[model samples]
Every structure is written in structure tokens, then in C-alpha cells.
Target: MPESTRERGRVEASRGGSVRLEDVAVRFRTKKKDVTALRDVSLDVAEGEFVAIVGPSGCGKSTLLKLVAGLLKPSSGAVRLRGEPVTGPRHDIGYVFQRAALLEWRSARRNILLQAEMRRMPADRARARTAELIAMTGLTGFEDAYPHELSGGMQQRVALCRALLHEPPVLLMDEPFGALDALTREQLNVELNRIWRETRTTVLLVTHSIAEAAYLADRIVVMTDRPGTVAEVIDVGLPDERDYAVTMARPEFARATARIRDLLGAASAAD
Candidate 1:
């Protein structure tokens, strides 16, 4: 949770633009049988806070994100935004997937404007937002560039710009850079830290990389396997003002990284 809302006691994440999941359990009814992807999963991300979820594969990390996004309904628990039930897709929360998912035919600028178009934003305002996004994400010169013309990192930057075009208060990222190379992923981590600070958007990121989660998240939420639940929530006590090289050198960062790894190891062994 961010310092701004710690006093409010996890209210924003569960009740408002800040996302919350309350004892949420989701079961899928497939043709063969019923599968419980998640059970008793509860979490809160305070306003302006960045939380990352890390766990073994099939831990329902994505399902948890979808619940908050209103793309999936919990069978036994509740998901709330601004104190209202999230029954369907919402425009106020933005999502970034593992892939850039940009249209092949559209240029970077047009791809960004696509969000505004879907939301029926005014043409003048959409153009203004598009320009601002292009500048902010360092796509100023490549506004006319198509997806293939850009590198993996650049493509993801455009995807991020599109996600943030409307300035949604809460941003949900599902391994947005999982497909990138190690060096590119490291560079984007730095960029993302800066962007998150500048935008001050509440973020909940699901990642497979412990190092990546430690670098970018304020709190790390560890989950159990299969019928997933919150195994632990570890605060990344390192300084908020973080840079890639220096932050990685800090003792606190090392401690956080090690502790999370141990917890995950323990979780794995228990299985």
C-alpha cells in the first residue's frame, strides 16, 4: 500500500479504483468436471500503491487479476470497486497483457487512439491524449510506426501508453514484459518504475519473475498452488525512489528477493 492510503486500511483496493478481492473463490465448470482455480483469495491494493502477485504456475494469478477486472465472477466471494459489485467489464480499470496485442495495420498513434475510440471519447480530446501518450512513452518519432517496425520493448511501451491513454486510476498488468529478452526486460523495469511514479496509478502486476516483482512492486503477494490462496504478502521495504542498478544493490532489496524466494520454495516443497 502507498503511504497515502495506509491509514485507510486497504479500503481503496477493495472498494474503489483501488482494487480489492474478498475471500474470492472461482470454479470453472468444464466439460469433464469442475475445477476450482482459486479459493479464499483475498487481497487489497491501496490507492496509488503497486502490488505484485508471484507464485508457481497454475496458481490462479491471472484468475485473481480477472476478478478485479470484472472479467470473471467469483462463485463464493465478492469483488468490489468504489463499494459497488463488479459484475461486468469496467472502463475505469486498464489491462495490459503479456503480448502487446496491437493491431498489425495500425500505427502506434492510431493503436493508442483505439482506446479512445472504443470508449467513444471526443476526437479532439483523443488526439490530445494520443500526443501526450506518445511523448510520455517515448514513441514521439515512431507515432507513425507500425508494430513490426518497433522492437519488443518499444511495442510494449506503446501497449502501455494505450493502457494509460485514459489515465485509469488502477492498472492491471499480466506479465506485460514476460515475452521480452532479459536486457530489454531490465530496461523496461526501470522505465516502468518511473512511469508508475509519474502516473501515480494504482498497479497490480502478476509476474513469474521474483526479481522483477521485487524491483517494481511496493508489496509482493505470494500465492499457493492449485486452489490458489494468499500465501503471504511481503512489503518491499526498500526506498520508493528506486533505480535499476542502485536499487538492486541495496541490502533491503536482497533481503526481499531472498525472502520471497524462500517462501516460494517452501510453498513448492509443501506441494
Candidate 2:
């Protein structure tokens, strides 16, 4: 018999990556039948590594992030964080969805404080951290502005700040800038890359944009169609501090994006 796909895909976190998935699979059972969303999807994300996941729509990219965040359980195999199995909702992670989802009544500062409040962090400590993040994310002057009063990008920045307010060691972003205009999205991508560097948090981003993935990730994981499995992982080969135009002009950038595009094309065609 051939080696099982699970056995072939199983990977160990030898470099102390802190996040590891071993032969992982997910299935949802409806009244009619069992539907598999992921199968034999194994990967290891190193500590402080910025990894991006790209694939066709409905390829379980978002589902993979939810597994790491402990928001969902695998049907078979394991998801380990710091060598411990993820068993439930992990409060130690920060998640930012495509939408900003800020509260209408709160100012940017208060919206960010919600995280601190939920964790019962000291008011002074939370406020101090909030101030620092506001400055770091270039929102210093807009701290008091309401969500409705800010631009789409600014609102997303506020959401980013809120997510980071707790200083989680891992950050999961699901197309955080997907809703913005191209120019705004490009601006936020630059900001996000900087933020990731300053914080040095492990980042797993799920995005549909190939350019975005190539620009932001240290490595990009390409997935196949439904019952998504890793098709390939491409190293981005760029410096930590990258200038948007300069990096985009580099040969390595083009190569990485092209490879990903090719892999995506092959994956789609194979389906």
C-alpha cells in the first residue's frame, strides 16, 4: 500500500517554530453526509515568522488559521502551540478579520481598550500600551476619533491596534485589508509589515492577493482546492525592512509571486 497522505505531510517543529500541525484534517457532518474541509495538512511555522497562506476561494485557508487560534478542532491529528495541543479558544492570540468591526459608540482609544478591559489589565498599563500602539501605528492624532469619523484604512488601523493591545504572541489576520481600495490596501500592507517587524509576533495571514502575500510574508504557503492540502511553500527572499517600490522591483519578488501564481493555476486546473 502507498504511504498515507497524512504520513507524507506530517512535519515536526524541529526549529522550535511554536506552531505545528501534524497530519491534520477537518470534517463537518451534516445530516446528509460528512464533508471534509481539510486533509493531511501539516505545517510548521517558526517563532516570529511572518507566513502568508494563499489559495483559491474555499480552500480552507481561513480554517487553518482558526485551528491555530484554537477556535476549531481537528477531526484527526493535532495542532500544537509551544508543543502543547490546542484544545480550546486561545486567549493568547489576536485575530483581525477583513472588516474592522469597531463598535459604533467607541472612540478609537476606547475601542482598543476593549481588549484590555476584557483581560482586566490595569487601567494605567492598558492606557500606556494603547498610547504606544497608537503612536506606532500612526494613529496618534486620531485616538479620539470615532470609527464613522475615520477612513477605511484608519478604521482598520484601529482594529489592528485593538488586536495588539493585549500583546499576544501570535497574530492571525484574515484579509484585514481586503475591503480597502488598492492604494489604501497597499499602504496598509506596508504598515502591517512594519508592525510585524516591531512586534516580532508570529503572523499567519490569509489573503487572496498574490502580490500582498509575496510582499508581506517570509514564506508563502500555497494550497489546493477544497479538502485543501499544502501544494508548496515558497520562500519570499526579501529583507525584513522592505521599501514598497524597491522590494516590488526586485527579481526575487517577481519570482516568488510568479511561482505562487503558477502553483495556484495548476491547483485550480487540477481541480
Compute the lDDT for candidate 2. 0.89
For residues 1-271, write the lDDT of model 1, one tens digit per residue: 2333353233444434466678899999999999999998877667788899999999999998888888888999889765667899877988999999999999998998899999999999989988887887778899999999999999999999999999998899999999999999998888889888888888899999999999998889988888888888888876666878898998878988898898889989998
Q: How close is every model to the real structure, measured as TM-score?
A: 0.93, 0.93
lDDT of 2 by residue, 1-271 (tens): 1111122222323554668899999998999998888999988887678889999999898899999999999999999886778999998889999999999999999999999999999999999999999999899899999999999999999999999999888899998998999999999899999999899888999999999999999888899999898988888878888899999999999999999989999988886
Measured by C-alpha RMSD in angstroms, how accurate is candidate 2? 4.9
- Going through the candidates in order, what is the number of backbone clashes in each? 6, 0
Off by over 4 Å in 2: 1-15
Which ten contiguous residues of candidate 1 have the minimum total lDDT? 1-10
> How far does residue 31 in candidate 1 sit from its true spot (Å)?
2.2
